[model samples]
Target chain A: MRIAVVVFPGSNCDHDAYHAFKHVLGVETVFVWHKEADLRGADAVVLPGGFSYGDYLRAGAIASRSPVMDEVSRFAGKGGPVIGICNGFQILCEAGLLPGALMRNRGLRFICRDVFLRCETSGTAFTSRLSNGDVIRLHVAHGEGNYFATPETIVRLEAEQRIVFRYCDPTGRLDPEWNFNGSLEAIAGVLNEGRNVLGMMPHPERMAEAILGGTDGIAVLGSLLDYLESLPLKGGKRGEVAREAAGAAQKGAEGTKGASGREAGGRCKAV
Target chain B: MEETMKAKVTVSPRRGVRDPQGRAVLGSLHALGFPEVVDVRVGRFIELIIEPKGEGGPDEVEARRRQEQRLDEMCRRLLANTLIEDYRFETEP
Candidate 1:
């Protein structure tokens, strides 16, 4: 299947994503410029990592408003699968496609290291290949990867099982020290309400090839292909079934609805 | 009317949010024997020189209204991340 790698003005990982999907996975891939208004009909989309617009004002804040984001939002509104890594995750949150925000790292340092991520759920299209609680090692490189959201939103995400991954030790034990960033609930990755979009701080493409370092990322990429293959052609009886699955994944997003209604007290911040 | 205005925008992390830089400074102070320092929060400020929008100097009330509106838009859309930060602005003509 064809995959689209969106290249923002300052995105540096476009080539890496292209290599992972085109060489490792043997899939057709194209580099879609951030200025482009459409996806050109790709089966899947990947928002690669980088300092878009030099991360001026705030990380991912500027890039999220690029013209391409309009179509990206529409594509996500459908059942198309989307994966955002590192800075891409920040963009997703800024675009309102994902909940919460990425704050400064708790240690106030730009951390770059391999960390273990335990798959919290396999219910979404992004993690269907892995069983729950499976651990994968991925590289994380960023200064503002600490995720924060209201307590109510965290509870909703937990109840919906949308937290696809959490920081943990190799043996699958979640320890505070193991959390590279002070993300709430030690969240390493999360799925949107529809479960088709995933935002994670780790760079899976960096670990997708054995030559690079590891092959753990294969599972994550492989699962996307599997999920894509499982869906039938658009506008058919089989398509109806796939749509139903997507519908079930759109759990209630309380924060998105009550941003102004909720009092700002007690909401956790990174300090 | 044309008028030159200086606007100062202050952006700070919302309360209950983590401020690693602020915490680091606080630690440094404590280590330097400034134990009385209770708390410290780090933030950023931006100075903007707003150019005249029209031919002559605008009326005082109109200039203040325009400056405030522009500053709010700038903060909301670019200068600050509303999700995690709050911003306040003051202008002088």
Candidate 2:
């Protein structure tokens, strides 16, 4: 599938993300500068992690308002799939495309290391290839990976099955040490209301190859390709899906609908 | 007559980085027996003094406004890391 990786000043991972899709996944990938307002026919978009705008004024804050974000928002509004990793995740939170905010590490330090993530859902296009409760290894490098939300928002997220991934131990158990940045409820990642948009702290592109010590990230990227391939050859436009998803998300939030399968507030309860 | 002009600026986190200072301050407040502390993030407070120019001397209000604009440029270009900080300015005459 064709993909676009957004590039902003100080975004160091854009290249890696582009190469992973181009060389590893053997797909056409484009680098869209932050100043650009168009997606250029990309089927999906990835916001690579890095110290965007030098991590000034709160990571992702300045970058969130960059010109390209307006396009990203519009693209997602039309149902195009978008993924934000590391600092990109910070930008997404800053842009309000996803719920909750990312806070500083509970340890008060920048963390750069590999961590284990437990997949919490498999129903969406992002994780349709993986089974629920599957464990994957990926790299996380950030100081403010901790996620926070009001108690009510947390409950709503869980009830909606929006909590997609959580920090976990090697054996798939939730542990404090594995909870790298002390995210609220061990949250490592989450999905926007319609599940087409994903924001996660870990770098899946960094783990797409076995030579990189693992290939678990392949499934994540592969899932996108899987969805793209599943689309009908004719009369299947992406913009329609994104718009529908955006509408559904607004409705979901307005309705205060409960999560599909999980218990209320259970996903983010302190462990 | 003496005229005085001053500008005050503050810089803070944009929205994403975990504000450890804010959280720590909250924790400290709780430890200090103040349970009302919920959120806190450390930021910078800067004060600048501007002297009037010319025979009539600097217009306090005008000088303060000019200095405030300059301070904003400084924050966006240097003083504050825009990626992680947000800033504001106040002027006094």
Per-residue lDDT of candidate 2, residues A1-271 (tens digit): 5799999999998988997889999999999999999888788899999999998757787898899999999888766789999899999988889887787888888998889999987756677667778999998889988898767878877877788899999988999988978898999888887566899999989998888878888878888777666554445665454345444644554455433321121121111
Measured as a fraction from 0 to 1, the native contacts recovered by model 1 come to 0.86
**Per-residue accuracy of model 1 over A12-112 as CA lDDT, tens digit each:** 98899999999989988999999999787687899999999998878999999999999889878865678999999999999989999998898889999
**What residue runs in model 2 are displaced by over 4 Å at the alpha carbon?**
A236-271, B1-19, B22-41, B46-89
Chain B vs. true chain B: TM-score per candidate: 0.88, 0.74
DockQ (Cα-based) per candidate?
0.72, 0.21
Best by lDDT: 1
What is the TM-score of each predicted model, taking all chains together? 0.87, 0.75
What is the number of backbone collisions in each predicted candidate, taken in the order shown?
A: 10, 26
What DockQ does candidate 2 score? 0.21
- lDDT tens digits by residue: candidate 1, B1-93: 365778899999889888888889999999999999878889898999988676335476776677688779989987888878989998777
Model 1 spans > 4 angstroms off: A234-271, B55-63
What TM value does chain B of candidate 2 have? Answer: 0.74
Best by DockQ: 1
